[model samples]
Target: MSGERARILVVDDEKVIRDSCTRILTTEGHIIKSAENGNIGLEVFREFHPDLVLVDLKMPGKSGMDVLEEIESIDPNVVQIVITGYATVSSAVDAMKRGAYDFIPKPFTPEEILLIVGRGLEKRRLLLESEALKVEHERIRRNMISLVSHELRAPLAATVQYLEVILGGMAGEIPSEAKEMIVRCDIRLQEMLELLRKWLNLATFDSPKMAEHFQDISLSDIATESIELMKSLAEEKKISLILETSKDLPPIKGSKVSLEEIFNNLISNAIKYNKAGGWVKVILYGREEEVWVEISDNGSGIDEEHLSRIFDEFYRVDGRRNAPIKGSGLGLSIVKKMVDAHGGMIDVESKFGEGTTFRIGFPKFFQRQKEG
Candidate 1:
């Protein structure tokens, strides 16, 4: 009657009420199911899966309020209308609170009931349409990200390689001045490439697919490799890299590459922001159900105001001291996404100008768990 016919369930203790609703809705081409009480209504709901439900209060056993609450948990999308003899302001308020779209008083005219039912059906239709639009928008966004990243990656990577070749003296010995310029260009281009990669990683990440790749991995080993990879950068800034791990730690379920990226991004940031001769410490151990990794650095710690947004994409502290530090601002964002995909938790603690510590906990691998 609203737009298209919908499956409707009518639940009431009185035979006349249920028959009346079924006859009215059925004549409008809607399919109908009738239940005598709240218990029967819930049973029919699970199997019939109606798009709308008309529930009556003052039942002998299970009350309509109980039905509304249970239906909300089962499927809040289904339009719910309460039929009540009490019909007091308090009763209506209580029904709405339990997820009723509207209430029809006892002995209502056929026209009044029809009007309420029509409005409920329209509301359900709009809600469904809104949900569909949101899903579509997300799909389009993901596609656009993939297309742009793929288009830019190849050309940018080639330009960086060509610059590296020249800097390596393959193009012929160049003047010292020209060499310095090419080196700077190479560095900037590389940073752009890194940004794009991280951005693509964040946008295209598939949590379900990631879970498929999960395997028992040692966090200590991943941290060690990341430390090794970042050694030269730490050396340039004269920052000391230290690793302290408890032995015989339990394995964590995760994709090795994803886990490695988490450690690398955090460790690199620590070194980049640290003052000369500062120390970056990585500590790993096992707690009750989680394998924990803590990366702490004696550096220019983040401000209190910026901590909340530190994981936001393209967000930076913008402090004068950090002006020289270059990043895509997507590193922490990507780290957080990957950790969530692994069913892990991440937290940060910092005191401005003092230091910062990032703690991540990965669920310990168990035999019953097949995927993340």
Candidate 2:
């Protein structure tokens, strides 16, 4: 009745009260309906689905209290106003606790009805608008992430591969200095690629639709493969990629894509943040109830102050700023999210200048576990 038309229902045993309310509200460009008793009020409520309801506190068949409870059961947010011939302070307060939006005494002025009902309708419109805005913002965020992941990343990856070929001397021979420069450019390109990948993965996990697709699969197989994939990166820095996988390391209930993401990020960080000629060690052992993974590196270790926030998005260790390595700092954050979604635990222990260690435990039966 204020900015937008509203649906209102009035329930009163008195024909005069019902008729008076209908005439007053209907003149304000509102859709109004009336019921003579509480039972018929409920029937009209369902059929009309009115946004606001007015019911007399004392009725012949069923009381206004009964109709208020029934309306609450249907939708707790619906606005309700209680009416009575004798206005009592205690009764008005009690009606409010029963979920009535307002209480008016019998012989309410038409102006009083319009003012109270208008306020309720405005509140409902604001709540609905707020919800719509939130949904729209989420949709736009998802679209931007999808576009960057596919459109921008594809071209950058191709360029990195082409530069790798030139640095590898697949093209005509070039000066040693020029070759070194190309390698530096290649490394920067690779950093960009990793950032894009990690950022995209972070957004994917953030989406509500990214629910876990768990499966009973060999965790050892995925770990081994992730380790092998990082061997090349380790070699680039002259670091050794060592693995100690127990022969009986069993399967885990997890998403294959997410599990691979978790393992790859841990192993990749060990290499990226390590000193040249250092080593990355990956150990996989199983407890009776869980599988434990430990990846340790003796690279430029993280300080204690940074350890607490290492899993936060876009958080980079300050100690590594002057170091040659660069990153988006979302790697560990993504790992933590994927692990948490699978109902697993991940933690890190690091010494300022000595080294760092990461431990992960995956339960035998994850809640979303499915057969691979």
Candidate No. with top TM-score: 1
lDDT per residue, candidate 2, 335-364, as tens digits?
Answer: 899888877899899997678899999998
TM agreement with the true structure for every prediction: 0.73, 0.67
Query: For each candidate, what is the lDDT?
Result: 0.89, 0.85
Off by over 4 Å in 1: 1-112, 166-177, 319-322, 366-372
Clashes of 2: 1
Task: Give the alpha carbon lDDT tens digit for every residue of 223-282 in model 1.
Answer: 989999999999999999999999998889889999999999999999988899899999
- RMSD to the true structure for each prediction, in A, is 6.0, 6.2
- Stretches off by above 4 angstroms in model 2 are 1-6, 9-126, 158-184, 206-213, 235-242, 245-247, 276-279, 319-323, 369-372
lDDT of 1: 0.89
